[model samples]
Target: MRAHHDRAARALGVICEGGTEFWGWAGRTLGRAGTATDGRRVWLRMLTAREAKATGKLWDGNQTAEKAFGTLGGRRPELLAVHDAAETGVVYRAELSTRLDMPVVSPDPVLRSPLSLSPGWWGSLRTALSTVAGATTDRVAVRSAYVERALPEFVGAPAPETIEWVTVHGDLHWANLTQPRLRVLDWEGWGQGPRGYDQATLLAYSLLQPDTASCIRECFPELGTAATWAGEAVIVAELLQSVARGDNEELAPPLKAWAKQLRERARK
Candidate 1:
């Protein structure tokens, strides 16, 4: 995959600096820090999969985000160029984007512990989220059927009727956020979702850090309100479903506890 990524860089006329290479889950994506021919720092990402399975929203997400958000006031890396080729029934797509100098807050998606984040960082994050939510798009992130089907079974809460949908980052976890400053990444899942879904995702991942969780709730007070319960319930169920799949098992305890609390709240 690294070889393919490097070759893709050469083909795109970008030079990959040899030190750091970032790999995504299950080897589906590889990203490297690089420079354009003009020495402008850039990030190059390569993805490969069977040609038959590579056509969909996930495949086109970054391009779609580039067109839809247009750099997002420097909150997101700008997608600059793309290179595509196919070989032996596999498709390889490479994307060159503006590289962020700041690193992600964590190596994992779930924040097992807390880190001190400045008030300014939180403010920037809120602004970025608000801007994203205000955008208009036909893309769907969380489907009602999934929420209706999974909520009762996974979260023990009846699904809320008439969920208000809003645009969201869709995968707003720790690894997708940068440190000392705020930048959101992994935009492949950004689209319309039930209100508070993004905040719920962040809060769910912060449960192990109780203070952090409280801070998130404080920052987005709407999260604990009845209006956002529909979205929050779905996010909790989604992560619990992940636990059932043998992923993020550590979140199981807090998630189950939180689900129980949500159920109690529903009863009230």
Candidate 2:
């Protein structure tokens, strides 16, 4: 992945500098910060053969996102350049994007504790998410069949009779959020989903921190409310499924608790 990133930088005519290398989970993605030949700071990210699937729109989310939305008021990274190549049977994709100088809210996707954030940060985040939800896109981030099956098994039966679909940042977790000034990272999964999908996801990841979770509710009041129950159930089931897979082990208890509440609500 590093070799691919380096190759892409060379091809893109960016001068690689500094040792700030970051890798995605299981080293699926690798990126380095550098400046363009014209001295513009940028980030070059490369997908490894394992994580590189060139078939689906979801696979090329970052590039597609640029077409779908132009920065979303600077909350998302701007896609600048792309380099695609194949070595053997696998394809490697590298993208150059406008660099975000802020650090992420958390290294892990799930927040284990509370962190005080300014009102300005919350306001910015709220605006960005709202803008995404209002976007028009043909991309599908969540499917009906999976929601129908998973909801009954992981959450409960009696799915909502109606659903409002909207554009969402499919993977809106703590690690994907930046602080001080808001910036959402990893745009490879933005698409249409149940209306509150992103908010529900961010809430699920912040379950351990009740204060932060409450703050989130205040910021996005429609997220887990009765009107958005279907979206909430979808994301709850998704995360709980991840919990069952031994991925979010710590989130298991809270997710199950939330599921119990959802089951009761569904029954009602």
Find the candidate with the highest TM-score and give its number.
1
Q: Each prediction's TM-score against the native? A: 0.97, 0.95
- Tens-place lDDT per residue, model 2, 23-105, is 88788788889999998999888885643456675568887888877888888889998888888777888889988888999
Each candidate's number of clashing pairs is 0, 0
Residue range with the least summed lDDT across 10 consecutive positions in model 1: 106-115
The runs of at least 3 residues in candidate 1 whose Cα sits more than 4 Å from the true structure, single-residue gaps closed, are none
lDDT digits (tens) for residues 1-268 of candidate 1: 7777878999989988888778898999999898999889999999988999887768888899999898888899999899998888999999999999998898888887668899988888899999999999888889888988999999998887688999988999999999888889988888899999999999998988889988898889898788788878988999999999999899999899989988987887
Candidate 2 yields a Cα-based lDDT of 0.85
State candidate 1's TM-score.
Answer: 0.97
- Candidate-wise lDDT, in order: 0.89, 0.85
Q: Name the weakest run of 10 consecutive residues (lDDT summed) in model 2.
A: 50-59
